[model samples]
Target: MSGLSTTWFGVIRSTIDGNVALSDINLGDPDGNEIVHDTIGKNLICTNMFPAPQIGDADDGIPDPSYPFSTVGRNVIGQCGFVLAP
Candidate 1:
């Protein structure tokens, strides 16, 4: 696993198994407003995703355990972003 970052209340843990390679990934909210967590994985390949969100707007570089919107699994990410949603 490589290239992982968070904005505000962001906490992440990566566990590598078998053979895997990850790059430029920011699992949960771009600003890390949510608790983005990752578990065991095997034979995986990822890149160019999970960028930090703009300053302010709830994610003020603070860790808020009460913030919702956690969990970044069971999804197909190929460039589209959650921040770009309506």
Candidate 2:
């Protein structure tokens, strides 16, 4: 028997208020293995993968002001500039 292996790579950019402007971004990867330089922000290498957090209404049917929930937290696999590999 033989084992199989595969690899994947990509880049991610994020902002605090989801107001990041694309015009300020300029990214290019001279080498396929990694990014050479980026003007937008720091470049992070892919490390791990996990399911994003889930959001739902409160048990009492009332929104909690202290712990409000939003769609922004959903579907977000990682922090800003996070990368994932398969």
By TM-score, the best candidate is: 1
Go through the candidates in order and give each one's C-alpha lDDT.
Answer: 0.39, 0.24
- What is the Cα-based lDDT of residue 10 in candidate 1? 31
Clashing pairs in 1: 26-50
Give the Å error, residue 82, model 2: 20
Candidate 2 backbone clash number = 0
Candidate 2 lDDT over 19-70, as tens digits, reads 2121112223222122111222332222222121112122134544553332
State every prediction's TM-score relative to the real structure: 0.23, 0.17
Model 1, span 1-86: residue lDDT tens: 46665544432444434433445656555444322333323333344546532222443456455542223333423432232112
